[model samples]
Target: MHTTHHCKARQSQRGISLKMVNYVLTHGALENDKIVLGKKEAMQRLADLEREKRLLMKIADKGGVVVVADGEALITTYNCSHRN
Candidate 1:
């Protein structure tokens, strides 16, 4: 899949803000359903809650978020302080 240069530029010029990066990483699965963000905004959009949960847990497992994926799961990515 192609990467969005918009994100790349944002991270390069200004360090990825914790809030915005968190949103991108979570795939719109915010805690308490309070963090307002468009569902369509996620890079790793899952079909439903179960899939989303699994995805988020997988992300939380690998040290916050790092762009990595395989055939078994969709390409999910995240950045705590930007993964160089």
Candidate 2:
């Protein structure tokens, strides 16, 4: 869950909260070096977590999230234009 200063700045600039970033990191799919959670993937994950109402409510947004990771630390995160 570690993030660089640059990543924190980007999160503030992009209005992407740390909670959302954590959600993407926990649920997103690995594509190359990034973890991506698009609308489609989010929907699928939502369905999978349907029984967990609280968890499901947390990640109900279909907006895409792309997280770049360096080992266990997070390098950066941004909203996905193409995936949404």
Per-residue lDDT tens digits for candidate 2, residues 1-84, read 579999999999999998899999998889999999999988888777776775545444535567999899999987564752
TM-score of each predicted structure versus truth: 0.25, 0.53
Worst 10 residues of 2 by lDDT: 55-64
What is the C-alpha lDDT profile of model 1 across 18-74, one tens digit per residue?
567666556554658454456574423445666978888877776576556797786
Pick the lDDT winner: 2
- How does model 1 fare in lDDT? 0.64
Note the clash tally of each candidate: 1, 0
TM-score of 2: 0.53
After aligning candidate 1 to the native by TM-score, how far in Å is the CA of 33 from where it should be? 26
- In angstroms, give how far residue 70 of model 2 lies from its true place: 44
Clashes of 1: 1
**What lDDT does the true structure give each of the candidates?**
0.64, 0.82
Candidate with the greatest TM-score versus the true structure: 2
Give the Å error, residue 53, model 1. Answer: 0.1
